[model samples]
Target: MKKISEKIVRLRIVVIVLVFLITIGLGYFIPRLKVNPDVMSYLPKDDAVAMQFEDVGKRFGGNQTVIVGVKSDDIFTEKTLSLIRDITDSLRVTDGIRSVVSLTNIIDIREVDSVLTVSNLIDEYEIPSEPKDLDSIRQYTMSKDLYNGFIVSADSKMTMIAAKIEQEITETIDTNLTGKALMVYYADKYPGKMYEFEQDADTMKIKINKAAVADQIRDKLRTDFPDAELYFGGLSFMVQDIGDIIMHDIMLLGPIAFLFILMALYLGFRNFRGVFLPVLTVLIAIIWTLGLMAILGYEITLVSNVTPIILLAVGSAYTIHVVNRIGMEERNGGNYKENIVAALKYIIIPVFLAAVTTMIGFLSFIYGSYLTMIRDFGIFTAIGVVFSLILSLSFAPAVISYFPPKKRTKTEDKPEKGIIAAMLMFFYRLSVFRGKWVILAWIILAGVMTFGGFKLERRVDLLD
Candidate 1:
């Protein structure tokens, strides 16, 4: 520890340049990172249900299903029928679809001119656009005993298309269709998810923002069918939606947390280096963790996405401790090199132990957790903790060696006794006078928490 601290002071320029280069290198990989939002992807491979589901998806098409609902004022109109025909055709050629069943292609057994005939309910290639033809087709579809709740609903309000195989048609909406309603189902097997990502021009990877594909279909529908409302559901769509939400959090929450931390550090330390150094430590740690994840072929999971904010909250403390020790050495009139070396030797061992213990706490999730993402969260967070310590020991002290703060006036060094300081002083005196009672109060609180833990119930949702 002594030798390392001496080198950090002796070669401060080299350390600063190396750290800058590394930070820039890691930052380059941040844009290429991806998010995985599927819940099933989090399940452990040893999970029996997941294994069975994977086998089934391989044998059939896929276990997951997509349901698209379309609503309009009237389902039997010439315009409405044409829209359904278009949607069915679009699904037929889409990747991962196994089959498609709609009014245009479903087989029908009907009495035509006093003789029974089996044929398609409507000509697949020719959808009726004329009013009389639309009316005639609706009547025929509604009159059949099998078509009432199968092809057309009991009431002619909603229409649905089924794709990728002839899936069971059951009573989806029990209520009679008063408003416009359309339903469609398409099931795909594993690895053939319905919302499979579209390739970029340069073949860059992307996450669940299936907007590339879904947007194309949605934009056309909105322009061509202004009167209809479209709704999407199913595993693939859920994953896509979750991906969007996680991206929003990653983009918005991390910066907000950083600003809050900056404000708090400024309030406490009242110096630029005090605030900047700690923030730099945590930020560089986060960048290193995320970049390492990308380089090692690990996609960000919903669980792993929280690492940045967690490291931001937890990792700053290591650097703060180093800065505090250096401040103490500075106030004693030590030179910059002497101050940094003395402070590092005094604080390095304790900070390293603190980081290791905290890392072990996070790593416990890896040894026992059933969710793969939970394990990933543990691994990356532990790595982030180590990175924070390394930065605190190396980058933080090296930077401090060159830019030791000016000795403050007596009043500035001793912060004013504001409301917060008043409260803190009160607590300090109370602790000194009534130390045993304070300890007893803490024990009582711990006992209450233990009792409460006994009454807690677990709620697990593996499917989510």
Candidate 2:
């Protein structure tokens, strides 16, 4: 260890250059990092519930359905009806849309010459223009159980356009299932599927990108009905919104956290090396971890979005310890090289032990969780901790050896009566005098937090 430290200091420039090149190379993967906010995709594939859910998706249509709600003072108005018609028409033609159900597209059952006839509520070429026409349409819609509450709101002031998106079928279908059986099933289930089957027998299995389809519908609604009060609800829209929000939070929170860390470090250390070296070490760890995730083809998920922040928080501690130890040793009369070696010898074992235990704690999540995102979070964070430990042991000491802390006289060794000092003294006295009470309070707080954590429910609804 001593020989390695000597070599590191002797080849400090080379070590620094190598570290820079490696970090830069890893940083290249930053742009390539994919963000996936689909909550369903995070479910463990081997989990029975997840497999069953996927099977359900495969048998039926995709789970990605978007409900677009349009509100107005009077939805029965000619203008409102016309806008609904236009929007429904546009959505029907949207790519990857399996089906669209709205006031305009929904089926209306009627007795035509004593024969039951089923047709679209609003014809493509015809829209309700008069008050009487809209009144009749509204009456018929309200009368139907399927349309009421599902498509048209009870109050009739708001209507929902439900669009079913088709997901891409990546797996091959059962080859044993004959086309004739599929055609018969389609004929009995969906009349429209009969025509599709007739057009192409292979059309029994269809593939479509549900997310892209949802994006198209959302874009159309935003572009064409900009003035309308549109509330998009459902799995697809929720997924998209969740993705956007996660990204926004990542962008907004990351810098804020960095600034806070910077301020805290600056105030504590009162020196550039003290603040800069620890931050830089943590930054490198974060970049390396994220880049590794990208290289491994793991998408950044909502759960894993906190990786950078976690790394920043956890990784900085070792560097701080190393920096302080080296500073203390130097101030106590050791030369730069000797202090660097001595600091490493004293701190490396504890730092490594702390890092290993923390990593083991994180790794427990990987073993315990059935969710991919949680497992990925565990793996990446553990990796980041490892990187921090390595850099703190190697690069940190190497760098600090070049910029040693100035020697302090005996007078400077005495604690100053500053605000920070006063606060520390107060805390020290409190801990000494009220140690038993403080411990009891902490235990009670921990118990309350644990009980509260168990009571907290998992929220799938992003809107809530």
Candidate 3:
């Protein structure tokens, strides 16, 4: 520890420069990280069944069925039946939809004399207009057992359109064209600046965004039938929903956590170095860990999206310990380099121990966990914690040395008498005055919570 501290102070310039360059390099990869909210993709890649499914995805694409439900007072009437037909036709032609099944196209079997015949439940083009014909068709349709409760509600007021998506997804081309000609036409139509395609004929496969495809399908449906009431469900829609949640989590949670951490740091240290330096270490650690994940082709998943917040909340502690120790040792008023070294020599073991214990707790999740999401959360969190510790020891001290810490004033030296202090006083009084009752309350609460924890239901779905 003494040797490492001496070296850190001796080569502080190199340490600072090297950390800055590496941080900048890692920061570049942060924007390239891709979010994959598909829960099935989290399946172990080494498993034979999963590999076979993935190969199918690469070749023929895959299925994620989304159901769109339409409601009406009378579904067999000409107007409602026509609307259903239009919806089926529109969705069938939509780019991302592999197939669509609805009341208009659902299979119907009927006995004609002695022979049985199979045909569409409702005739797409020949919807009945007359009341008698419509009622007759309705009676016949309602009598059949095949369509009940599955394609339509038992009461027949609601009908569901099931579109099995080609999960590879696609852009719905406006024209009936193929190959390079289609591309050329769009390029000419949109002109240079009007539109920009993220992928061409070749790159589309290499860079696929399933959530974008799902959203496109949703937008197309809503545009085609603006008046109709539609309810969306199933895996493809859930994927889109999860993708939205991940975006919010990444954009909002990190900043919120960092703000809270900053507030806490200010309360603790009452100095700029106390807040900024600790947070800086955490930010750098997060960037490096995320950059590593992106460069290695691991996705930002629903589970891993919380990585930034976790680092923000937990990783800053290492730097806080270092900063506090350095502040304490600096009171001796020795040489700057000597004081920094003395502080580091004593604090390194405690900081490393605290970090390693947390790392081990997270590392435990990598084993005996059934879900790959949990395993990934464990792996990256462990990595991030370690990175935080390294930066706290190396980058933090080097930067701290550059800015001489502010002298603690007599007022600042005294403990705060804010809400936290009042709360502490209350707790201290309770512990001293009502110690037995406090112990009894804790015991009862722990028992109840332990019982509740035993009854907790575990669910695997990533998106609600």
Candidate 4:
């Protein structure tokens, strides 16, 4: 410990410069980090539910379906019917669309000369202008069990156009027993093997960017019908909305939290170095942690989204403790080297012990959690805590040694008598006068909260 303190004081400038350069290099990767809002993507690939989901997609084609709802006072009007037909035609010709189901595309079953025949309810370029034609079309649609409640609503005022997506397929042979069994099962179920997984020239092998596709559809609808009302619903839209909200909170709340911490530190220390050093330590830790995440091929998800805030809240405490100790030693008539060495010697073991315990607490999540998001959160937060401890012990003292605090006079060392002091005194008096009752009340409250927490239900609704 003494040798480390001597080395830090001797090589303070070199350490500061190295840390600055490394921080800048890591900051470059911050913009490259990707945000993934897909909750299912966070599940481990070997998880049963995730494997089943992939199997279903492979056997039945892409599971993603987009629903376009068209609203109007009456859907039977000639103009509304024409609009529907136009939208259906446009969607049918759009890329990435496997099939479109709507009134314009669905077939009508009929008996022609004692022979069953199927024909489109609305032929291409055939607009229903007459009331009789519209009525006939309505009667046919409402009577059919397939399209009655699936495509058209019960209110007769809203209709839906469902587009099934055929995602681009990537071929890979699986050697696992489960994969082999699934392949055999699927082959046996479909005798002719009509659904062969093949790469299509027009389809993407990777997951389709549903949000981008939804935006394109929305733009087209808005351009074609300026006054029409439309609502988009799908898994992709929900994921996109979640990503937007996460980004908004990070941008708005992150800086607000930093400002609040800054205010608190400045008011407490009344010294610029004391306020700046702790904030700088936490900032660098966050940058390094997030950069490491990007390099490890991890995307930011809902659970890991709060990592920066967590590091900021937890990492600053180590530096604050060390800085306060050094400040107190200098005020009591210690020289720069003596003050720093004494601070490091006294707090080094306790700080290391605290960091280790905190890291162990976070690492517990890795074993307790089934979700990949929570596991990644644990891993990254533990790394941040380590970085915080290292910076507090090495970089913090090195910087402080170079810019030693000025000796405080007797007047400056006096206790504060401000509103903060008054509040502290009041709390102290209460604790001394009513210590037993206060302890009893806290125990009861904690037990009630713990029991209530255990009864809480888990909800995974992304849209809400």
Whole-model Cα lDDT of every candidate shown, in order = 0.76, 0.80, 0.82, 0.80
lDDT of 1: 0.76
Best by lDDT: 3
Clash counts for the predictions, in order: 9, 0, 0, 0
Which pairs, if any, clash in model 4?
none
Best by TM-score: 4
Q: For model 2, where is the 10-residue window of minimal lDDT? A: 192-201
Span of ten consecutive residues with least summed lDDT in model 4 = 190-199
**Could you give candidate 2's per-residue lDDT for residues 1-464 as a string of tens digits?**
67766776778788788889989999998898977777887888889998999888767876678888899998878888888888888888776677788877677788999999998887746775777877887888889888778777889899988887765433233466665775576456434311223323344544443444566678878998889888888877777777788899889988988899899898788889989999999999898988898888888888889888888888999999999888877876757788788777788788889999999988989777877899888988999999999888878887887775666777877877777878989999989999999999999999999999999987655667
Candidate 2 lDDT (Cα, whole model)? 0.80
Give the lowest summed-lDDT range of ten residues in model 1: 181-190
Per-residue C-alpha lDDT of model 1 across residues 1-464, encoded as one tens digit per residue? 89878988888888889988998898888877878787776777878988887677657755555555566677777677777777777777654455667777788887889999999888857877788988898887888877788656777887666653211122233243222321112111213222332233423221222322343344545666566766665555666677788889889999999999999889877788899999999999999999988888788877888899999999999999999889988888857789889999899899999999999999999887888889989999999999999999989998887786687688876767887688888999989999999999999999999999999987865345
Over the stretch 110-148, how does candidate 4's per-residue lDDT look in tens digits? Answer: 889999999987774787789998888788878887777
Per-residue lDDT for 410 in model 4? 75
Q: Which has the better TM-score: candidate 1, or candidate 3?
A: 3
Backbone clashes in model 1: 9
lDDT, residue 50, candidate 1: 82
Cα displacement (angstroms), candidate 1, residue 397, comes to 0.8
